[model samples]
Target: MDHKAAKRRKLTDKSLPNVILQNPDFAEDSQMYQSLLEMERKLDWTITRKRMEIQDTLSRNPSTTRTLRIFVSHTVSGQSWQAGTESDNLTHSETGENIPAWQLKIEGRLLELPQRGKDKGPPRKFSTFIKRMMVEFDRDTNVYPENNIVEWPRATGHHNPPLDGFTVRRTGDVPTHIRIVMYLDHYPEQYRLNPDLSSVLGIKEESLLGVVQALWNYIKIQGLQDKADRRLVRSDERLRAIFGVETIPFQKLPEYVKRLLSPPDPILLHYSFDPSLPVVEPERPTAWDVEIKMEDAALKNRMGVMLHTNKETSVALAKMDEEIALLAQSLHNSHLKRTFLQSFADDPAKFIQTWLESQSRDLESVLGAGASEGLTLRQEELRRSEFFRLPWVEEAVSVQEGLRLASKGM
Candidate 1:
């Protein structure tokens, strides 16, 4: 209901794929480019975390009794070997060598660990079976909502006692290995196989098991039982298991090179002036022109007298005109820059707003025909766009604060 909350939800939702697809030119500007880069980086993080989890799991079963182990030659040779050496007790089992940062060993041939077919989750009957269990969940007595689907089938043979324990379905451990859909917070279509993958996999009874798409879809619809904090606590109760949150001390380079470290958020790039440090200001372009115009008659007369000849006066006039034009253009440029900064405090956010606004404008233009009011309304709407709605807060913080934020969905 609130403007800010609505904006936040709209921007973060992954289900808005249609919205993303509709605007092919979503982020063509400098700001949008930066936003894309930052979004890519975030997705990279999700990928990195997944890879690390897989690596850790694989690391446990040295010879791969459980899951297959496929070693990347470079990862093992360089860091794994060196890392194995430092901590004598942490030596490799077979080689008995100390593990360095990430060193590994060479072999005659690359050993590929074969993937075991997913353990079929024992089939269970639908909700109709649950009705026979005589489990009475009378919603009139409680706040719990009633199940609307008349065809809702009870999960039969779900006797495995989650009675004392909680069911933990990890995004990683899911059988179909679905990827996280950006913005939508939903599974990709690949995992949502048509007419139920059960039919295609030749799985009779169409019972959702072994990371069934149906279960995932249900979980998404019902939402996860655990809160964010609950998830971390349950998943990694032992903090000592792995070292995470790499801490790199902030080492400032000459201000000029700071450009290389651009704001992690693309939007931040839109509003920053030439770096505050004088050395970092970009070199002046040869194309820049300077012009000065004399508004006073006396000033014009003095220039005429000084020049003496008409030819000289004409030449001076032309130069003055050029100089004046340049100065005005530079001023306008400054204003535009200021406007951009004031709007979003970053290029990416501004770019997104501009794009959305542009689309709205285009639509208004088509609908309004020759009417000018639509254009005016569009201009007003642009002024009140998300660019001005959301504030760009700084993410950088002290180590403790950073860790706290990271833990608390920073």
Candidate 2:
């Protein structure tokens, strides 16, 4: 009875906390948890910093849209014949002596719409809003649109400079009507596809994004993707002719497709200028309507509201994240304590003996003491055929083989 009482006292003296505190693996795991928590905090701070930077940039450059109007006018100005010695013999009866010169004027303006409930009047027009305008003529003309056309910000005028108008002297051999091409800022440019591309896409003109999407669809339908590598495309006969290659990389499709695209054909407009009529008629200037992509003010306002972060909400979120991290750490510590106590409660003496043996083995390994002897003993035990014949060994091998086969199948 005395011996049994001494054994019980010895087991009771070895507490669960002492055993856990001495474990090297548990200490290493705790340090790793601390490092992970620190990394998470740094990651959260980086995300918040980036978000704030984006918000600041968005606030500085708020997007807005404006309406642009293109105006064109045609008028005829008569030039009287000067008293010259060369044409003195020519009879005044002939109409060739006095010829009328026709002039075509092209100008543009930006219109500002009134506020919803504040102003009730016609849209205000401004000439300074036009950043750049390019006008191209169908045939050769005397006057050309100026290069790098820019309007004065403070200039007050009915028309923008450099693109006011053009005058033509000879009209006998020239075509009756002409085609004018205009490109405006803040507008989506359209492209016309070549015959081969058009045949494949079934579209003559479309936006660049639309063309790319259509090409992607065609590739999907034709199954032109390479079997071995998805990034490469096996071009069909039609695509081969268009791209000039049997196989093409998917990324280079856009560069090759751009070669097959051209600007859309110019629109034709006819004008009849009468010298007898007044220069400024009631319906003198002809206007052509064009569609422009504008920034949505309502959508922008919504985005602004979303981007406007509340200081209180941000503080609350940060506090919540910190609290959650603390709770997670507390939970992890509680779990470790619970596992230690449960093992001790199952069999106190056995748990204490096993824990002390494990710690001694770890200490010996760390100090490089008696490691060769332990390694030799383990090798001798493993070398015996009886070790492989154990029931648990077969079960472990079966489980490992099953996991490997499952991974390969996946």
Candidate 3:
């Protein structure tokens, strides 16, 4: 019999503590149980490792796993612009079908080769490396209701820099990018990066094309260039076309947003001490102010409805009451997206044209003027349909009154 069985036979009438004291063999049995538990735990660890490997295989990975996309347009005074106002005004362009992103089709064939007992099959065919899907960025740098354009001090300094997005990725037989899940990029500190080991890790590696664009965006709003003498890069491109530690080249845009071609420090995340510290604290307005806000909302709602149904007006005032109600509902929720539809009620042609789905000849007209003068292309997006013109409302109201007069004439 085992140690536990022998000890149990001798402990018939003894209390638990007394049993352990008199029968020292019982203590040995306890140790044996602990040893057995350790072995089981080790077994579990082995099983876990194998399960993870199986799961890794179960998830069919694509050859090209990841892709970086950029949305770029022109902005003159980026930082001075209000974030809340910009969020409201930001819009997407329309295409023939008017979808947010237009998908591209690639001629790729399925690779199903090596039949049961036969030779290998043909390789997958691909016309292009990766498919391009267009995302629109429609800012109201165009004709609209006269809201003052917030301008910052011009880059009157030495350098006028432009930004560029430079992407470094592995080439494949098929032109598709594969995203690494565990992420091997040497630059994980900046979470968006996919560390490529083909080069050095945690060092100056390939510049993330997406990051270059985002960096440009951040720089446009929060530039590092001294506000004065910043135009030197633009004044004489031959002499000084670069800025900062990385020879980020200057272009003809709002920012001297330079692209770091080489690898640098591992982009680590900014670990904050107090996220709760209010950067822009909320102010509690008085009771009278609340009443004014409500009245404004009501008036804006009425105006919006009238504007939305009237294509004759330049503004968007569709179903103003309903639109306001929707806006109110959206406001009731606390979660914030990067942009909101409420602000674009003035004009959205800027966004619509960029994401163009309509097969209209006017698209060229809209786009051509945009490149030069920031014309109809970047008009603020109206949250409502085109029927919201002022003339439409006047006509509708007049038509109803005219019908009543006709009945009186009868």
Candidate with best lDDT: 2
Write model 1 residue lDDT over 1-410, tens digit each, in one string. 22322433344342223333443443342365448547756765665565565456444322211211111121222223223334444646476344322211111111222552333333221111111111122222233245311221233365732121111111110011111111101111112222333333333222112224443343345443235432221112211122121221112111211222221111000001111123333243111111111122333344444324467656774565455446545644654565565554334434555867677767887876644777765677667667544544232223335555567894
At residue 330, candidate 1 shows an lDDT of 62
lDDT over C-alpha atoms for residue 347 of model 2: 52
Candidate 3, superposed: residue stretches over 4 Å from native:
1-27, 30-33, 49-122, 126-410
Span of 10 residues, lowest total lDDT, candidate 3: 286-295
* C-alpha lDDT score of every prediction, in listed order: 0.32, 0.57, 0.31
How many clashes would you count in candidate 2? 0
Provide the global lDDT of candidate 3 against the true structure.
0.31
> What shift in Å separates residue 386 of candidate 3 from its native position after superposition?
99
Specify the highest-TM-score model's number. 2
lDDT of 1: 0.32
Model 2 per-residue lDDT tens digits across residues 227-335: 8999998989998888889888888878878888897654434444444444343565877655444444544465566556578866775666556556555655786
Q: Model 3 — TM-score against the truth?
A: 0.16
